[model samples]
Structures are given as C-alpha cells and as structure tokens.
Target: MPTRRYDNSPGLGSLYARTVKATLRKAEYEPDTDGLTLELPRALVDQDHLTAYREVTGFSAGPALPVTYPHILAFPLHLDLMSDPSFPYKPMGIVHLANTITQLRPIPMHAELSIKVHSGPERPHPKGTVFDILSDVSVDGEVVWNDTTTLLSRSPGTPSAHADLLPDPCLEARAFWDLRANLGRRYAAASGDRNPIHLFKLSAQAFGFPRQIAHGMWAKAAALASIQRARALPDAFTVRVDFRKPLLLPSRVQFAHTITDAATDFAIYNDDTTITHLIGQLVAR
Candidate 1:
C-alpha cells in the first residue's frame, strides 16, 4: 500500500466539509484490491486535553493513557478514508459496530509517536457490508499499540445476532451514570471526535437519532476505567467491545462487570438493564 504522510493531524472542520460533499456526490462502493494508508510522522499529546479526556471518560490522572484513547488520533484518518471520493455511503451514516485494541507496551503522556491508519479488508455482513480499519502507533519503528475497528454500512438485508456477546444475567458489580445533556459536547472537545450527531440534538435528529448520543469510544473508555477502579488492568492487554446501540445523551445507564483471575467481562446498559448499549471483554496479555 502507498502511504500518505502528514506532519500534523488534519483539521476536522475541513474534513467534515469534505464529508458533506462526498455524501452529496456519493456512489456505490465497489470492492477493490487497492487499499489506502494515512500516516502521521510526528504526533504529540497535549496534556491539558489528555487530562480533560481522563475527566470525561473516568480514567485516573496518570501518565499512561487509557487503552482506548489512542483511537482519537486516528479519527481524522478514518473519516478521511470513508469520505474519500471512492467510498459509497455518507460518512455520517455509517455506524461503528465493534473495536479490538491491543497494547504491546505502556505509552507515556509525552512520548512522540508515529501513527498509521490503513483500510483493511471488506467482507459481507448479513445486513449490508462490513470493513476493518487497522491502526498502529509506533515510537521509532517499534510498535506500542494497535487496533482493528469494524464499521457497518446498513442496507436492506437479514438482521443477524451477536450470539457470542450475549449479556450475562448475573453481572454483580453495578453502577448507574446520570449523563448530562452536554456530555456529547464535553466529550467532543476532549476527544476531538466532533461528530455532529454526538454534539447536538438537532444535528442528531437530522441523522435519524432521537437525540445526541455518546461516542462509542468514550463509552468503552468509561467502562474500562470503571473496571480498573475495581481491579488493576495490566500494562499489556487486549480489550474488545461490540457497540449494541446508540446511548442517548442525558440518559441514565447501568454499567456492570465480572472479574476473574485471567480476564474481565463488562457491559453498559439502559438504567434498568433491559436494553444493552455495549458488551466487552478484556484479557491481559
């Protein structure tokens, strides 16, 4: 694959404006053998934003970043690829279906890193189509972190079930979060995932959501932070989550987890635990 390098992160505003044009001039995606790669040769973490991210996502104040935080750095790359002229769907319409992240080593808050994001293979989904976006963070060519994100572009087809991720009825440790209406806006500033649907009620309603929703990555980080509060998470670990549904802002939700000697199983749900929002598992490597 050919890589497009950047000295700095691309501006989200311009990318979003491009997304709008792509949506207006969209065409059906035809699978191709070629793949795109976007790279940042030098990336720096801003402490203030990192601290703010920790506050919004329930991570502790520390030098090492939460396992899910690095995804923010790849947000523009993901958006750029999906909004490119060749992509078929409206960038805003595609849904984040799942994520799998692996930490090879701990990342310090001040380390300069190289981030690369590539378009992975496209496969058939029962509903429509599904694809993977692979990413890696490296310090001088040594990889410290990586992830695979699955996205879904919905169309008319048979609905399928995630049988392996079915919620466990006996999740014991539980907590309820009273999310505020401005939670989306707050997280957007902290995480740089300014998806309009997650930033305002009207913008969300325009996209068919009844209200603004929380970012899936934020939800995952919050869950992991909660899990860490109960038990320590290893420096080398793998955490994977399937986002079941949109979590409307200002909504109260239940979070619970089951811890064992080897791994942790966790989830987020509606206040009464009837509608599941996310299902995840973390294993220390």
Candidate 2:
C-alpha cells in the first residue's frame, strides 16, 4: 500500500496539532517492536461467554470464535486515546471505512490468554487520517494470534454531525438472507477473508469446529441490514462496531436495535440468548 502523506491544509494543520498533543500526553508511546503484555481473563472464555461467542461468530455447531476475536482487544486502546480530553476528535465522529483481520492460529477454548497492543502514527489522507494498530494475543506466553486494525478519522472540514458528540446507542439491522454456504462464499469472495473454518466441513474440523462457520463481518452486515429495514433508510451511512464475541454457524442469531437521538446500538444474541456480539454505535451519514 502507498504511504499516506499529510495534506498541510489549514484544517489539517489544526487537527494534526491537536491530535499530536493529546496523543503525546497519554499515548501508549510504547516503542514499536516492544511488546506490552496483558493477562487475558478466564471470564473472557467462560461458558456463558463461549455460548455468546459461538452464536455471534456463527460457530454454534462448529468451532470457537475464529482467531479474530482477540483482535478486538486493541479497540479499547483506540477508545482510550480518542476519549482523552485533549484528543482532537471523538471516535464516534470517525468513519470505519474498512477493516481487515488476519489470523495466525486457532485460539483454544478454556485457555488463559495474554495480549499486547501497538499503534503507529497518524497517516494522513486527502479526506481524513488513518492509523494502524497491531495486537498479539498469546496463551501461556506463546503467541497465538496477531491482528491489525485500521481506523480513519475524517477531517473536521468534512461535514459530519457527529464531530463532537460522544458515541451513543446504535440502531438495529438484519443481514441479507441467502443460502448458508452462499453467504459464506460471498463474504470470502468480497473480503479475501477466506478462513477454511467457514468454508468446508473437513477444513473446519481441522480447526476444531464441528461444522463450517460464518465470517464475523456477515453478522455485522446482518445487523446493519436489520437497522436499515427497521428505519427504512438508505445504505450509505457510516458504521463502527466492536466485535465483543463471536457468532456460530447454522443457528438463529437474534438482532436488536436501539436508536437514540444521536446514534444507534445493535446487539446480536444466540438462541440461548447470550450476547454473542455487540455493535457499539452506527452513525447515519
């Protein structure tokens, strides 16, 4: 990918200064390649949590959440930095233009895990700024999964109602319905997120699943659909979701939406009713 360069526009100059000051004061500032360790809670894999994970990641009849769930741990770090009083922007105001997850291993169920997060400097774009975050999720001191997430914060000169508002509840939405296998294939084709655990029985079983699973984004898309259908709105708005847990395959995952004046909240649950996944807020453009 090409490196994003600073625009040097008046607005960008102002936003950059504010971002630098806020980031400098409390930034994780940990050196690149230096690892910070965090003890992962057993509660994160508790039976109840597992059930929710299975439902949300579409692993009900299959394996545990794809190795991707741990990637979400880094999101809190972004929240911490964005929420700092000195920070120039509110995360809710930013648009999640794109997200990609690359998995390294199969995260075992019922295992204690550790995580370390590293974030790079702001990479500027013509319309916004992009930052890169890398996280390593380990178990018993051995690296089990490494993930990267990118977030884009649009320039204030860009029109947005959420500029200063804090994140609020998200509206609910459903996913487009298709054959299960077709849904899996479509997402893989579009996302280049071809995890075998979501493709074939033998492939999934090799990864500790009883059956094939669904991509995490599919559930997110479903949630977005549910919200759009309920409100009868167009599909051009912005969305930002935190993948709290996974949803399993071949199960009915119920989606609920709650919209406040400022934002929308969407949650997905398994048939057992555990919160398999949660989307913090979806902003209407």
Candidate 3:
C-alpha cells in the first residue's frame, strides 16, 4: 500500500471550524441499513496487498473478518458526513484519543451493509477540549457493530508555546506484541492499515522502536474484549478511552483499568509497572 497522504499540518480552515462547531449535537442522522450485515467484501477479505493477513488476527481460517476492519466501512461514511458542507468538523486538527467497539457477531466476508452516525457536544478537557462521535452499523435491522471515538481539539496555551519545557517523565509504559510474521499479516488484512512500521523488525527499527509493534487497533480490540468479558455485556453499545502511550513489539506487560462512574473510566499500568501504553473506558450503549 502507498504511504498515507496525511498532511494535517496548518489545521483546518476557519469555515470548517465554524461549521463543525455549529453541528455539535445533530440527532440521529440515520443511513440506509437495508442490507447491513457484518460481512467483508471479497476484495477486502482476499486483498493481495497484505501478506501478513493470514496470521495475527486470524482472517484466513474463519468465516469472519477480524474485528478491526469494520472501521473501513464506518470511517468512509464518517468522512462523508464530516464533509457534507452542511455538517461540521475539520479532520486535520483533531487528535484521535481512543476507539471502542462491540461486536454482535463475527463479520462475514462479502456481505452488504449500512450505518448511522451520531454526533455530540465538545467535552471539557483538563487542558484542551474534546468531542465524541457514535456510529452504529447494522444488518437487516439487527445491530451488528458500533463504535464510539473521542477526538481532542486543543487550544494554544501554557507559556505561550515558547516557554522552557519541564522535565516530565514518560508517564506511561507500553509493550508491543511481536506480530511480524503472523499477527502482522492478519491485522493488515483485517484493518486496512498496512503501514510498514508494523510489519517487520527492520522496518520498525528504522522508526526507532526495538521491533515491529502491534497495531493500535489490536490492543484496542484486546481492551474491548477485556471489558466485555469482565462486564459480561456481549452487546455493549459504547466505550470511553484515552491513549496514553504507544506499545512496542515482542513483549508482555501488565494491564489495568478502573471505573469510577457511568461516564468515567481509567486504564493504565499497575502502580509498580513502567511500561504502560494506553488508558480508557468501556461505556454502556
């Protein structure tokens, strides 16, 4: 796959900013979900680009697509909504904080689908501000998958962008699972995120990490699975999350999470651990 043409520098235009703010809480903008189903298209499941799709997330030996690929269907629609000219949002400056999803059943490769997107208000941040989005995908009137993502838009501040930096330790510790041969292939086919940084040891080492790192979505999937199993909610509708740090490859580390209320949750490393990578929550639908 080609390098993603991600040039989000300089931010979005003022028109886009104002437009995005205006539609802060658009109610149920439903899309046609007539043939919606958790099925992957033959083109997606049989993609020739990612050789690594056979192993890590397990795409070849099943009747389902890995959990990560739903974003392919959902995100394009998200982009469509954001660029509606009537809708509001500038994708350039927003930081993706976290992604949470629930799977009603395995997504079968080569099925038709549809989606619905919900937008919400800006969440007050400790330093900056954040926004939330909800998207639900269904098949034949039965809901199949859903995701809630948080994007943060920060305002310029603190020392006026020219102050001396304080010595802040890397607050999070993270470890990556080695997936170069097996896991990498599986994740690539499943997620459509075939960035080479996640493919091999040498490829990752060039980027300054020790070895090939796991896909952020893989860890995300694991986190969601953890929450679902613990809460025993096979059909959770929403989730809250914070990405603190990136996890490196070929390793094992501790995982911990705590919930204080309906809308608040924290996930991080154990008190004595240093390799923490992510923090977030699982919310009810």
Q: Please report the candidate that would top TM-score against the real structure.
A: 1
Worst 10 residues of 2 by lDDT: 1-10
Query: Residue 202 of model 1: what lDDT?
Result: 97
Q: Would you give me the overall lDDT of model 3?
A: 0.50
What are the RMSDs of all candidates, in order?
2.1, 18.5, 11.3
Of candidate 3, the 10-residue stretch with the lowest lDDT total is 1-10
Model 1 Cα lDDT, one tens digit per residue, 1-285: 666888889888889888888878756555464666889989998888788989999999877878888898878888887777766566667878989999999898889888998877766677777778899999878999999998877777346733224345467538889999999999999877888899899999988999999999989999999988988789999999999989999899999898887878898889888888898988889
Pairs with steric clashes in candidate 1: none
Best by lDDT: 1
lDDT score, residue 6, model 1?
A: 87
Q: Provide the TM-score for each candidate, comma-separated.
A: 0.93, 0.42, 0.51
Q: 220, model 1: CA deviation in Å?
A: 0.3
Per-candidate local distance difference test: 0.84, 0.50, 0.50
lDDT of 2 by residue, 24-50 (tens): 564433333233322333224455544
Could you tell me the lDDT of residue 213 within candidate 2?
Answer: 69
**Candidate 3 lDDT for residue 278:** 64
